[model samples]
Target: MKQITVGVDASSESRAAVRWAGAEATRRQQPLHLVHLWLTHGRTAQAIPHEEALLRAAQRLLQEAEADVRARFPGVRVTSELVTADSPDALVTTGGDPAHNDLLVLGSQGLGAVPGYLLGSVGLHTVAHAGCPVALVRGAEDPARLGDGPGPVAIGVSTRPGHEPVLEFAFSTAARYGTPLLAVHAASRHPALIGRDELEHHAAADHDAEQFHETLRPWRDRFPAVHVVEHLSHGSPARAVLDVAPGAGLLVVGRGHHAALGPRIGPVAHAAIHHALCPVVTVPHG
Candidate 1:
């Protein structure tokens, strides 16, 4: 069975992300893979007597978390591991993790620090290279949808053909959520003529916007429920999506295909990954 992997750090945000991941696993009837990574560096001297005990404690903690996931979602299988590493990467990728996992959930920031990171650098790296879809959730948002209503899943698409996977993923997720998907295509900017009148400027901008919509027509048809909206913005691509994310429940963005390495979406995807208010699902361009 496909799994949903969540990187847990015992922090509020990590827990929040965990709760969200657990709900999703239940929703999809998939197993939950929870990982807790401990950082350690070898010392010249002998290790402390409590070091071994600490590992056991961590395992117990993970077991408790797994129990919570099972109680909330009884039919779903849950598994966990306690790993000690000197770095963050191994804990995240699961040291050559299995490919069966369909998604990886992570906190935007860690627990309890007053000045929490909105997107840690480690999280960013996984979003870029992880084989499966990655969801970056914020701890501030409620893990349980107690008061908030679920909204449409918003997915961003470039005119690029490689974004098909992302569009499909977003549409499927929207169907599962029973929510409409708003697929957005942001128009590329053309220079406003130096001395152009107001009407000319508006005309130029409108033309580009229409082109943007035209490019998205095929996508809208394939994902029938996606109420496609084309945004004609003069600024950065990431800026356009971030500005719209606050109104959405889920945001989906695409990474460029490795074959087209020159036009890779790492920077733009990275921007949306870090700045978007809603949980962001980064899909590697297939």
Candidate 2:
């Protein structure tokens, strides 16, 4: 049972995130924790209110959001909180209270220049820095299909590089969703397979793709119902993953250094956050 949390800021984007979280929580039969972090200093009209009243206002906002969530996902156990400070996302993050949470969900565009709310800096910082799996959701392409529930969860692995953390999360999510897990090892540089004939070369490439798939066998065994699938794709890994992101129920990517203490995962994870159509999960590695 995955315990999921979504950061809520009373913005449309955050609400969208809450709706997505509520539905996912229902599908997983998990609790939905709606967190709101309020800062004392602000330029908003509510800034001048009595501190007690401000807190009440925040609570009311979360309660309203909770009602909406409950209306849509009656099965989801909804919890609301109003933490006073700027640590909105962090307060709800597993980094602060690791024992209670399995995942963190946030909205995209809370920082976008557009008049509408989107993923803000807090959401980005939390995703990059959270202790547990973090998901960035920006609503759905089809609101009607939100009830369609989770589908195949995609995990990106490299033929030459291993992403154990990513594999673990993907397997766990697949098992939770009762859906399939697709392991993709996308090659950034494409080197034609060695063969004199076109058909033979294509066969070699396909064989290499199968090898990539075979590498994930050990993990697939851990999750018998995981329904493992594989792909050996060429072109930019990030772009390819994003291109196929739409149909996925959830996308899982590893956030680990190619070299420990190095910074490879940050940029790739950033790209995925900004582009993926479905909720993107980033699993950090040591």
Candidate 3:
């Protein structure tokens, strides 16, 4: 059976992620796997005097998380695992594989002193290279707030060719939740249109309007029940999406893996992941 896997540590952020994953697994009727990585500080056998105690403490953390999830979400089948991974990359490599998990969920930041409190190194790495979609639980993560309420499931629709998976996920989520789907496309001011006449500006807006309608046609047919609202905003892509994100229940964006190394997420995705007021899901495409 497929599982909704969440990485856990001794942080409040990790506990929040567990709660979010538990609610999701219960809704989807999938098993919830709470995995904790035991990272050793040094190569030597006697790296620290309290090695045994640390290991025992980690085990207790996993057990407590599992029990809490099971109790809070009675329908969710919860399981815990203690995986020994030496590096952050190794943990992402193992847990992010789609063959092992359906959706990998992580906290915005884990238990560490790493910089960028919004997204630690592990969360950023996994989002960029994960085989499946990575969900970063953020903002008002209390278990009470995780519900199929009124707000729409929004996605930043890219005109770039390879965003089919992103659209499918967004539409399906909105359909499942019985909420509307908001598709936003930001039309950046073209360099060619610099100092152009009013007619040219109107022409650019018209062209973008046409493209937005054309792109959404097939998807509307595919998921007829999803009420989709298309918005063509005039500004930076990230700002456009962020504007509509406040009232949105969930925000979905595609990760543009166009480069060969480093900085996995594109600017828009990175901004949304860090700044969106709601939960942000990064669906890898291209």
Please provide, for model 3 over 41-116, each residue's C-alpha lDDT reduced to its tens digit, 9 standing for 90 to 100: 4557675777788889999999999999978899988888888876776656666787877788887752236543
As for TM-score, the candidate ahead, 1 or 3, is 3
TM-score of model 2 vs. true structure: 0.79
- Residue 123, candidate 2: C-alpha displacement in angstroms: 1.0
Q: What is the full ranking by lDDT, best candidate first?
A: 3, 1, 2
Candidate with more favorable, higher TM-score: 2 or 3: 3
lDDT of 2 by residue, 184-276 (tens): 776534355443668866666677677777768877778887777776677577766776676688888877654655533465576677777
Model 3 misplaced stretches (Cα beyond 4 Å): 41-47, 109-116, 147-150
CA lDDT of each candidate?
A: 0.72, 0.71, 0.82
Error of 3 at 285 (Å): 0.6
**Candidate 1's TM-score:** 0.82
Among the numbered candidates, top lDDT falls to: 3
In model 3, where is the ten-residue run with the lowest total lDDT?
A: 108-117
